[model samples]
Target: MDFLNYAFMQRALVSALLVGITAPAVGIYLVQRRQALMGDGIGHVAMTGVGLGFLLSTSPVWMATAVAVLGSVLMELIRWYGKTRGDIALAMLFYGGMAGGVMLINLAGGSNANLSSYLFGSLSTVSQPEMTAICVLAAFVLLVTLGLRRQLFAVSQDEEFARVTGLPVRALNLLTAVTAAVTVTVAMRVVGLLLVSALMVVPVAAAQQLSRSFTATFAIAVAIGVTVTVSGTITSYYQYVPPGATIVLLTIGAFLVLTALATPLARRRARAAAAARPAGDPAECSIPATRGATDEVGV
Candidate 1:
């Protein structure tokens, strides 16, 4: 409670809350498409932008967003055109982006220590400009994720079907990727680039264990995300721990707890389903042996 008195903590909490809401919102789509790790790839690519920002003496948040968007677009194109060798291309992109960041940051006269905060998050250090940027980015993310849910769902669940339904599959895919990249930047300060994927993915996974529908899963995941983030941020403030690591650990804890609770829920649903099933003729009927056949041939 006392920590909230400080302006820095206030900013940190606001950013953490926003990150909680937005990360899982966009992440559910990625999980639907079986591309849960795409957030990690975008995080890697955004590193170069962070470095470039430092070199150019600009805001890393916006720079990382620009660079991440381009990288995500390229990744999407590779998915389209490089189906067979896409993994290799993505590998190169991830590592190249990371290496470029290291090199550029060196050139910018900054050391690894300077990048430590961005790499692993330092919510307490967020400045007024960065806070403004985070708010704007979060608004855009919420608009895309919530406002266009049905269209994004159609594309992510089945691209070919979405195309057949005239849903602008390509545009939607690009938008999802771009939105995911922006989410990476939005969460960069709260969870750090390295751990942002966990915020994006773990809550969704946890939610899926207990949900029967996409809508339920989405709602549950957002709830779990918000729970862990706010709690973790406060814990970090008191414990003097790394906020990113603390938040990620708490998310994992929520995942495990939900997973354990899912077993009984699943069994309850199964029993209910069995009871509600319509009774009908058995597929295989047992016929009694004929009287004549019952007599053994002893000859």
Candidate 2:
């Protein structure tokens, strides 16, 4: 309660809430497209932006957003043209981005301790400007994710089918990638880069255990994301744990609990379905072999 007296804590809570909302909003599409790890890759690239920001003495959030967006677009292009070997190219990009960040930050005279704050999140250090940036970025993510849900859903579910249906599949894919990149930046302050993907992915996975449709999954995931983020923030404040790690652990806990609950619920549904059937004796019938046609008689 005393923590709320501080402005930083207030900002951290707000940032957590926004991160919770936007991360899953964009991530559900990635999950649907079977690209759940895209957030992690984007996070890796964002580190370069953070290092660049330190080197240039500018805002890390915006720089991370720009770099992450570029990396996501490149990844999408690789997916488009790199074919079966795209994974190799992506691997290079991921490691290269990380290495570059480490080098650039060192060049900027920033120590690993400084980098670690961004890597694992230091919620109490969130500034007013960072909060403003987070809010704006989160708004953009929500606009893209919620405003274009159907088109994105269509593309994510089946690209070829979406293309045939007259949707601009490439454009939508680029937008989704860009949106996810933005989400990575939005969450960077709350969960940090290393764990942002967990926040983006785990909530949606947890929601899926209880939902049968995309709309339900989206709603439930967002709800769960908000819940865990807020809860984790408060817990971290009291327990002196890292907010990012706390939020991610809570999300994983939610997933495990939901999975356990869903198992029995699924079995119950199966049993109910089986019990709903009308019982009757099996009808007896036999078909004559080779002589069937000739032996057939009019009733």
Candidate 3:
């Protein structure tokens, strides 16, 4: 309650809530796509964008969002059609962007203190305008992700099948990539570029351990994201710690605990579900039909 009393803390709560919802929503797709490292790639690109924004005297987050979106689209394109290795492409951008950002920052004569804030986490640095920007972008990310859930799921589950089915596989891939980029931007404000992906990926991983289906995992990841964000923010306030690191550490801790318990609990539940099924029913053990009542993309 005391944490909520301060205006900055109020702003932090809102920021955390928005990212908490937005990050894992997009994260589910990234994890499903097996591009979990995409966040790290995007993070490095964002550093370059921030440096350029400082040079141009613009809002770094907006610059980072635009660059990251563009970067993501290009990433999809290269991976889709490039002769070179996809991971190599991502790695090139990852390292090159960070190097460029350093040079750009030096040329721009930007402050080390300000740059450090983006690299790490700094709740005090979040201003009113930044908070509002995070909200708008985060909301947009959530809307697109949920709206295109089916198509996105198809693309991730099997790109060839999705393309054959006339699902606009390329377009859906681009859209999801951009949405993830936007998610990366919003999360950077709370978790910093260095560890933004942890907030996005860790919760989803934790949820995956416990969930038996895609929808259940998605819901659980969002819940975990919110829980960690709120709890970490409050704890950071009282402990005088960096909120971004605090939030991420809590998420990691949750994942560990979930790992310790999910296996046994999942085994028991699986047994119960099997017991509920008739022993002679072969259909119950069969795979679900394409996009059936129980969408089995991840489970």
List where candidate 3 sits over 4 angstroms from the true fold.
273-299
Ordered list by lDDT, greatest first: 1, 2, 3
Give per-residue lDDT, candidate 3, residue 171: 84
Query: Considering every candidate listed, which one attains the maximal TM-score?
Result: 1
- For model 2, residues 68-179, the per-residue Cα lDDT tens digits are 9999999999999999999999999998998898889999999988899888887888999999999999999999999999999999999999999999999999999999
The 10-residue segment of model 2 with minimum total lDDT is 281-290
Q: In candidate 2, how many Å is residue 131 off? A: 0.5
lDDT of 3 at 114: 74
lDDT of 3 by residue, 1-299 (tens): 77777899988888888888988999889999998878878888888888888889899889889888888888888887876687788788888888887778878998787787888767766898888889899889988888888888889989899989999888888888898888888988788888888877999999999987889999999999999998888898898999998999999999999999988998899799888988787754556557765565675
Name the TM-score of candidate 3: 0.90
Q: Write down the lDDT that model 1 would get.
A: 0.94
- Name the weakest run of 10 consecutive residues (lDDT summed) in model 1: 281-290
lDDT string for model 1 (21-65, tens) is 999999999999999999999999999999999999999899999
TM-score of 1: 0.93
What's the ranking of the predictions by TM-score, best on top? 1, 2, 3
TM-score of every prediction relative to native: 0.93, 0.92, 0.90
Q: Rate the local accuracy (lDDT) of all candidates.
A: 0.94, 0.93, 0.87
Off by over 4 Å in 2: 277-299
